[model samples]
Target: MNAQAKPSLLAKFGDRYAVDPNKMFETLKATAFKQRDGSAPSNEQMMALLVVADQYRLNPFTREIYAFPDKQNGIVPVVGVDGWSRIINGHPEFDGMEFRYSDALVTPPGASAPSHEWVECVMYRKDRGRPIVVREYLDEVYRAPFKEGMKGPWQTHTKRFLRHKAMIQCARLAFGFVGIFDEDEAGRIAEQSERDMGAAQVVREQAKALPACPEEQIEKYAAVVESGQRPAEQIISMLQTRYELTPGQRSALLEVATTQGDQA
Candidate 1:
């Protein structure tokens, strides 16, 4: 008898969610993962999304867990408000939660909205029997509108946003949830990642345009790298000031620098 065929990643994922894998993927592409660059999600990215979904027991069809394409062609898993509520409530140890608001309200300069002084979240766990308290300052957690004269949710629902921030922070402290972020945090991380990628690309292009290192200077630099005297980064910066080093030369220097140790 022939052995049972191994199910594909999508097939397995579909089984978990009790949906048709092909249809689910198509739906996810159309609805959930509309990349900022307008590119379709790659299969690997989809697989990764499924993995995180399964790990978190989130329902993508319900918009619980979603993703954005990040730099280096990866995905940043983002949980929705509903998703956060689900995880916090569904956790076995979770018992109950409460909130406290500060009496004072202050509007930061250039902000169109006035926010509470702070919001505090007190979370209870069945196992611990102690409440975890987290206080989120409105000024510290507040995000202004992306453009002037525009009213984002932060501007419109400042108090609600503050409460959400407090609850999320408290949840992290209570549940130790890692490797997932809310939409706001994910957006900031994705933006920073893109900026870093752009900076790296510019550096690579600039390095390529530089003139090749002179052969005579190779031994001097090799000795310098092997000496373990200064940091490898500092030595590279000193060399790059004069000439361009190829990837091989850079790798060799790094290898020597790492291996020489204090014995050098």
Candidate 2:
């Protein structure tokens, strides 16, 4: 007899949105994302993407939401402009929105085109007492061309990008949308996080290469713990950077610190 195929996590919805989760995943695997290495998104990645899509009621088949690999071996859910528009306007309490543009234009440090000084978005919610307003400055939000000198939408459609930034910020404040990011913002954050994690790993490897703590130094630390001059955790962390500590040494230090702390 043949084994049964397990249903996808999205199967719980049972076509409520008229989407077959497993079929959609199979289709998206071939089309949604074009990786740098020409690889398709993994099943796990597709599942994660679907979860976020379901949460926000976005249609991945229409490219409303997509996935990007994150530093911590997870996915960053990136929403399209249309997706943002749908979510904001679809909110039950969303009353209306208005935009304000700056009179002056200025070119940012790295931008290829000049943009308005700022754009502001004011979003009103029927349930709220006051409207939520957010201002985005072109100079601050402008994205420069890639290192290869290729210009992105920010450089080509400066005003639109500025307006989008303002609207997204305003919506976040008004609606409390969390864990979703714009494409550019998601890329930058993921890359920066990966770099930070890589640096942290290097530091950890260097710390692990350090010599074991000397018996005399360990005794000195135990004495300090007994005296309650410094926190046990703090001293242990400091010592860890310079030397490897055994479990027994850590336990002994904790015991001494506990004894001293109890007496006080």
Candidate 3:
């Protein structure tokens, strides 16, 4: 197929490439809230997020998470395929090098989408560490893949494919931060699965029958069910300080509690 007519490279991998957005958000939040004294993962983390978004055909909004030494000449938050490639390969052109994501947690407001976030990393000259101007490459300049016998050397082709796979996996995991599979649809499907297996009805009935148990017995049972340890007499004694319960209700409570314990 011609370059413009070719399917997205990401689509060939399968649906597993898609990410749960909610989970992605949670992971991003956790990473951002971590202590700031440590070094940040910056490029690696951003690459992972992009990989997932690309696989899912989701467009993430780029927000600046941070600008080192202020934005005038520093690296700023950016996105798109080129940005991801630059971070991963550490080169603007396909130079046959391999790269891996780092494990640093960067502070946020560096760049965030409705679903994920990223921190900015300053680009510096290798020898002097002097800042370099970050520029966005135009689509034409990057050269459409498979065009004009423009393929890189054999090593570059192999390494690029490998890196793309790695990015897809990382993106899948990062997608969890955004609640991708945590929606009502997933919940409904889970409930349906349980019902199909005859588990949901049993649990519902057990819960409904729990209220007739005696307060003391129910408290003892609840404690054991919740904590995996039998309640002490003192713990049981404290039950009467609160609400009342009936003997049958206590029996039901014990059944429900025991059932829950079994599940746990």
Sequence-dependent TM-score of model 2: 0.71
Q: Could you give the candidate ranking by TM-score, starting with the highest?
A: 1, 2, 3
| Tens digits of lDDT, candidate 3, 1-264 | 556774433333233336454454444434531223443435445445445555444444332121111112112222333434334344332223223333432221211211111212233333333432222211111212334444432123333333333442333332222323211123344445656657767766665665433456665566664565653333334543443455564555566556765787
- Which 10 residues in a row give candidate 3 its minimum summed lDDT? 110-119
* Candidate 2 Cα outliers beyond 4 Å, as residue runs: 1-9, 12-21, 33-36, 205-264
Provide the lDDT at 88 for model 1: 97
Candidate 2 C-alpha error for residue 261, in Å: 19
Tens-digit lDDT track of model 1 for 1-264 = 999999887787789879898988888887786577777688778778878887788888788988876666888988988899999999999999999989998986455667789999999999895799999997777776788877787877788878888998899999998888888888778789989989999988887788998766666777877765676677777888778887877777777777786455
Each prediction's TM-score versus the true structure: 0.71, 0.71, 0.18
In order of lDDT, best first, we have 2, 1, 3
Query: lDDT per prediction?
Result: 0.82, 0.83, 0.37
lDDT by residue (113-175, candidate 2, tens digit) is 678999999999999898998999987777777765676788778888899999998989999
Candidate 1: regions farther than 4 A off: 1-13, 36-38, 109-112, 201-264
